[model samples]
Target chain A: MSVDTETVRRIAHLARIAVKEEALEPMTGELNTILGWVEQLGEVNTDGVEPMTSVVDAKLRWRQDEVTDGNYPERVTGSAPDGDDGFFTVPKVVE
Target chain B: MTEFTKLTMAEARDGLKAKDFTSVELTEAHVSAMEAARVLNCFVTETAERALMQAQKSDEKLQSGTGGPMEGLPLAIKDLFCTDGVQTTASSHILEGFVPRYESTVSSNLWRDGAVMLGKTNLDEFAMGSSNETSYFGNVINPYRRPGDETPLVPGGSSGGSSAAVAARLALGATGTDTGGSIRQPAAFTGIVGIKPTYGRCSRWGIVAFASSLDQAGPMTRTVQDAAIMLGSMAGYDPKDSTSVDRPVPDYEKALTGDVKGLKIGVPKEYRVDGMPSEIEALWQRGIDWLKDAGAEIVDISLPHTKYALPAYYIVAPAEASSNLARYDGVKYGLRHDGKDIVEMYEQTRAAGFGAEVQRRVMIGTYVLSAGYYDAYYLKAQKVRSLIAGDFKSVFEKVDAILTPTTPSAAFGAGEKSDDPLSMYLNDVFTVTGNLAGLPGISVPAGVDGQGLPLGLQVVGKPFDEEMVLRVADVIEKAAGPQAAPQEWWKA
Candidate 1:
């Protein structure tokens, strides 16, 4: 699986991490190297094997839907990069 | 007594309880040591004021005979563990200046047991790198060095600060989370004791998520017994983390029988990787001899999937990391770079926030999980992960624990392998299998290489069998006997 600059640019956009145009070629080389190494997974025979989602197989316990915690809105939003009276501020999405 | 900073966690605990020395005095000593060891860049944030306040409270409890299990013990916290009202960055620019409103469950457990916090220790950014060099705060210098070499060796990561601080006696112990070999590898490198308890043994609630399934919080201490004591307090069932195992927290300190008689120890033949340092092989052999000398049975075992652990880990960890990190899209918290639009803002924030290694992993993860490659890459990697875990389960059924070298070699100098990710990934070759299998593992300082840098022997046990792991590690520590790093030059 050869990763090229276009793939790097696409994934970088998909991952929502901007990559400067000049750095794309270097990123492609590193990403290709990593993907090449990971290609070793192809050697393992995994026929009929279940993908291990959780190492421990316990069921997720269902809890009451009511509010179990969190009443302080200030604490929840205090660390937001841009915040107002009670909500996070961002580039206007609805305009 | 000698300098209070020099006391082990056990010694400090006893001395505080006996009124021989006060927690305030102990905290003061470590605070001074922390200040002096700034050259190591081990601690990103020092909470000396809060430490003193907590110590005063601990002293009152000690005086009244009402102290908790970890009362008055000062320790360092890896910044990955969210500390309420204290900046927790995971040593990354993305989380820079992020003061978590709630404490991570593992850290809160320690504080509830009366452990005093010295500060937040540095780590590989987002706990991703092996050699701590990836940390935005800068690399933590290993207190241990090659004889006559002052080039500043790395204190392995992403728990390098915890291991370095503990080894340098800046703090008696520290909390470290292991996704791959974050805790054990650094512990081995710094000549300290670090244990990664069973997956879900320690609560992950409020912790900055790395690779969720493999990520686990554990203790890094100077002594095996101290590791046991700290692990006990740090582990428990928390409602906040559904993955947390609900079993009762055992008195891990009591499990340190210091005797491995009648125990079946497996020496896995597969761990004898090609081109390994002779010192590591010799240390593994020495570990076997010591266990045998203590009356434990040594049997040869094989984990064929071991060879694939590293490659499989890279895929799975980064894939999950890509997913977990999506939440940091310039909205909720931390650093945000402004853009003309919301999507561009996210791209700009993340691009400026994460380091190069982090960006690379995210790109790889995004590619693998992308539409066309999901089945061939991510799904196949997941199946390989199952086989890796199965390898351990089959072996554990036949033996009580497995013994191997903690890392392929002792601490390497900073920037030694940073340019090549594969070489750096090899640092976790011996330790990641345990995480893949969700087993408990500990690294005990076994001996030193020709350069006098410390080498460690790893003991891996069945899931939820940290007791056995600690017991076996205690035997190794006794055999190795209280190996502390030679005078920390950073203190000068």
Candidate 2:
């Protein structure tokens, strides 16, 4: 299962990583190499085997549905690349 | 009277308790060593001021006879763990200067027990690469070079900086996170001790997630006993991490009674991979003989799925990484490259922020989990992971622990395998199984290769049974005596 240049572009888009037209071919080759190597897993007969959901068999711990921590907006956005009045500011998504 | 930097954590703890040296003096020694070894690029940021301040506080506690277990002990943190007010980059350009508002549970636990920070050490960006070359900061030079060769070698990564730091004695011990073989491989490369405890043994709360299931924080130290002591302080349950096991962390140091009598140690034939160097094979034989001489019953075992671990790791780790790193868009934090719109901005920012290796992984991850390929790739890999874990489960029922070579070979020159990702990935072939099974494993520097480079032997134990792992590793350390430390070539 090799990924073509178009698939690389598609996945790169899906991954939110921009790839130049000239670089797509090399990117495709790199992805295909890794993908091809991982293809060896196909040889393992996984019939009736359950896919691992949890590495450790522990039940999820339940807690009361209340705010245990937070209320510091400044701290929340302290490292924001772009912020306006303690809210993360991004390009206009609407309109 | 001794070089304070030469003291191990245990020795320093005793020396401080006996009033032989203050924490500040010990910290100063390490700070000086770190300065001298700056050319190795082991640290992304050096927190000498903060470390000194913390050490001063520890000295006060020591004066009052209230020092915590790790009080005044300066340790390096892998940048993957969040340190409050200290930049944690995971050695990525994207997070070049990102500081967390809160500390990671593991590091916070260390500080709670009196450990002082020596700043964040470099790692493969997001813990992605086998060689430190992928670090945005720069590749960490393994302090151990081939005999008299001046050519720089890679400290096995993505915990390369932490491994190199500990190996170079820049810090008494450093924190390392192993997802696949990040911790063990580097430790093996640098001829030190590193242990990745059971998956939930250490809290993952504030750790920058790579492969959520596989990533575990552990210790990289000069000796197995130090790894044991550090692991005791590092392991605990945290409510923030839902997966954290609600069990009492054992006195791991006490478990190092050096008793392997009548214990069953498995030698999986599958680990003797094709083209493994003669020295590594001989080292494995010596390790087995050492154990056998110590009254350990060495049993031949077959973990057929052992060969599939690295390949399976590539699928699971990146899939989780793609999801985890999705949070790194333009608005949140770190580097941001502006684009026309939100989507374009994310694309540009990520493209510019992540390095080639990281980009390649994210791409592979995106491809595997994308539409139509999820079942064929992601799900299949997970099933293979289960089979790998199952193999260990069955083997552990018979053997107390398993012994194998930590890495396929000793440290290779920088750029030797960087061009070939698969070849670099093969470095973790022996170490990844422990991560897949969520078991504790430790690497002990047992011998040197023909190049006079260090090699390590590994002991993988049952789930949450780090005590047994430490016990076996301690025996190996005693048998190996002491491997040669790298000459201080980086000193100006």
Candidate 3:
């Protein structure tokens, strides 16, 4: 099914991205083109086939939950564009 | 010393061991070439000072006969791999000017092998797009030109920079990551060799994520032997990466016996897609002939799910990408656009930060994974992915490896497919099946197309069988002979 402008607007919001109102119609066209191409996958008969997440069929390996790395808060937070109070700071969450 | 830059990685390593020239000289040759070829816009960042310092250390080690296998070699790194203290952009504005506090597992392994860094190379934004045009930094101009045609072609993405740098002799070797056809297709376009190891062979620890399941790091080099040496250093189990396979990393370089006697090479019937250029088809035929002449048995095979791979790949890749990219929400690192609140801030930052292609993918991913459409899109794609992998599994049981064209055609002019995304995605039709199967695949520059642009042959092998893949690639390379470099119009 071709994507509509309204759905495109909703998708941008769901993805936490902002698409200008002016661009949503064109973006809808682009998404529809891609979707139109991928819709062929629906034709494949995948009855009872398990969805393969990882190609290598190995048990998920686990490890001890311990702090093996630390003490580099200065370096860890160095790339942050905005941070304060010894942590990553975003815009005010509460009014 | 500038001539040293023209030598293959293996030759340069031997030359450095013989003390014919210092590592400083080798580094200087490539560093100077990088400067001269700036018109290509291949490198996103140049580590000249760090390279010189590392080269000096390598020289000291060589003096004492203590340097590692890849000692004194200078190589370009695709920006996807984070280098400590060096800005790693992955050619996306979202991560604009983001310098990692740590290094990626693959680069760390290269450094431990004494490979000096030339710098990080450019790539398609977040390793998206078929051509390098989507880079926020600007497109990487292919160092290649069509025969008698002055139009500059694209070095295929998203590892275009790595392939171009290696082909242009700006670096002896370069690191490239293939999520789809990123590494192999670019290698084909530039007339070099690139090998994408099995999915879990190289650690994805610090590299920027594209599709977690499909992303893999590999070597783009001037020769199959060089690709082997680089892969040997780059592959190994890493505890830091949970998906990294826990197994012994074979000595890939040493395993290059270059003898394919009695080996069964499968030529899949389904690969004869409609409208394939006659030259590409002939090139595939030549690959079959060469393997047969080299005492390898040619067998007809069928990978019936091949036609569905590209569509499945597009869905699966973006679905994973939408999840992986959610972290860049203007909170932790990189670019941040302020807004009324946290949610609006995320919206604004992502809108202004991501390129159009990236945004398009994110939108597609979000739509497909949404509540009502999940099973129809994302889940269906996953089941199709299983069928595709099963095709390869059965084929591998019949033959040692499968041979197919690396790309449907040679490199095209930049912006040629920018208006049409489907055309761009089709460039990977021949290569994406390997990634979907999570197999080791290498592209060897086998022949030049009618336009004199280089074309490549791809070898897909069993999981963790990079040794076999590289060996078969070597046989093809020997039959193909060395390819001449494109004229350096980008040179000063």
Candidate 4:
């Protein structure tokens, strides 16, 4: 149940958010408070209770699965922060 | 006419039909009001030119005898919905300058019904905050206030701007997307009617995803009938959205008879949480008394997993949001911070683009979904989600609908809970269960609290049974009686 500073740092790294060391204390405190609130769920006797997944019991409704979206590439790529030749470009990965 | 701000959608539609006033006049009046009330910061982007053009087109349609119920009606859209060529930020820096090329199915449907778009309203970043403070733009001020009180109250959020705008008559009706009480809470805070329709009733194809499973687009308006009219236009099957239900859209406006005679209403015992303001409790009881007076059976029911809702929702929503927001890395659509390396760029852009609260959620979501913790957190939350839904199902077997306070308290002053995130999250506690169950929930103004701010009572119905939910809400809205006309915040 303990979330250490290192764990919090790792979480920040994974989530791609920057956190200052000074703010970590309060952030940790707040996170622990939230976790404590969530921990209240442990009190319920869920022994025989089934875990609910989706709100409705229905399965993922299937579609035609056809490749209908072909024309909007220009529009699709237009919103990208960086794009070239109809493909989104990220910082060079395999340097 | 006193002012366009005082006119309801029904009255405006009647006027348009009678040719007593043109859609152009209505649109112009709203535009002037919006210009005058700019200090409320209700709108993120005002599409006056587009709205005026649409209104003129609507007038032409009426002249040609091809008008619909929503024809010539002006509405503000939440920034979360993608409108073609309009900035759709979801009130987050991550989406800054992101203009969607395609329109959301909900907005498209509204446009097809001839509803003029006034602009996009501000919201909590990614619909995360209960108060409007989390918006990347700025806090949206409530358009109404108690006489002689200068304290700015939160209009409620992440649909606070929409609610305030509609409540102040900046727009006739506004679209709001609720992932967890975003629409209803704000509506309650602003003393307007907001409904979170049964999941799948409206398409989510172009709504900027917050939590795909729980998110639903609904209408926020000054009255129940206006909400019904807007909902009628907004709800339907959308082939592009996989989750959209292909059910027949009902005649929502006509269904509002303000009568719930012999209806079965359930009062959940667990919702009476300790420390709930006595005034809210009294307002809830008053709602029950009113329902009983309407010849309905008021039965006490138990939703055993009610307490588990907030925790489970926190888990599920952040999990889904983490996945949905992963697309916002520096490389994709939105702001990109320049860097020599990909990792640094990703970190920098996200850090720069996402607000503090958003980062907090992404961290929580990432932790819960991380390896070695997935089974204990995310998976466990999903399981609990089912139990919560089952609790509702079992209760519905015994009662027609469940009623609870839409929010724990009335509109708190802006920044009251900005320092305490947990207290802010508690605002949606009563409403999140409906989202977890995929049941329809509506917030109707119950009465004013001791502070003279509004309190709302939520009516929850069986899944896909929005007609019954609105019917129950309409009954409460009428019985609770007319609210004092919202004070004009723009007047000096």
Whole-model Cα lDDT per candidate? 0.91, 0.92, 0.92, 0.88
Per-residue alpha-carbon lDDT of candidate 4 for residues B1-492, written as tens digits (9 for 90 to 100) = 647667889889888888888999999999998888888999999999999999999999988889987999999999999999999998988898898898999999999999999999999999999889989999999976765898888999999889989988899999998988999999999999999998889999999998999999999998888889999999999889878888899999878877888888999999999899899899999999999999999999988888888998888888889888988886658899976788778888998999988888888888889999887777788778888888888889988888899999988888789998888999999999988888899999989988788889999999888888888898888888899867775856
* Candidate 2 C-alpha lDDT tens digits along B1-492: 789888999999999888898999999999999999989999999999999999999999999999999989999999999999999898989998899999999999899999989878999989988889998898899998887689999999999999999999999999999998999999999999999999999999999999899999999999988998899999999989989999998888899898899999999999999998889899999999999999999999999998889889999988988989999997888999999999999999999999998888888888889889899999999999999999988888899999999998899999899899999999999988888889899999999998899999999999999999999999999999978888987884
Q: After superposition, how far is residue A33 of candidate 4 from its true place, in Å?
A: 1.9
Q: What TM-score does chain B alone reach in each candidate, compared with the true chain B?
A: 0.99, 0.99, 0.99, 0.98
Supply candidate 2's per-residue lDDT for B418: 89
- Chain A TM value for model 1: 0.92
True contacts kept of each: 0.91, 0.94, 0.93, 0.69
* DockQ (0 to 1) for model 3: 0.88
Between the candidate structures 1 and 4, which one is better when assessed by TM-score? 1
Error of 3 at B72 (Å): 0.6
Separate DockQ for every predicted complex: 0.88, 0.91, 0.88, 0.69
Q: What lDDT would candidate 2 get against the real structure?
A: 0.92
Task: For model 3, give the TM-score of chain B.
Answer: 0.99
Ranking by DockQ: 2, 3, 1, 4
Worst 10 residues of 1 chain B by lDDT: B482-491
lDDT over C-alpha atoms for residue B333 of model 4: 85
TM-score of each: 0.99, 0.99, 0.99, 0.98
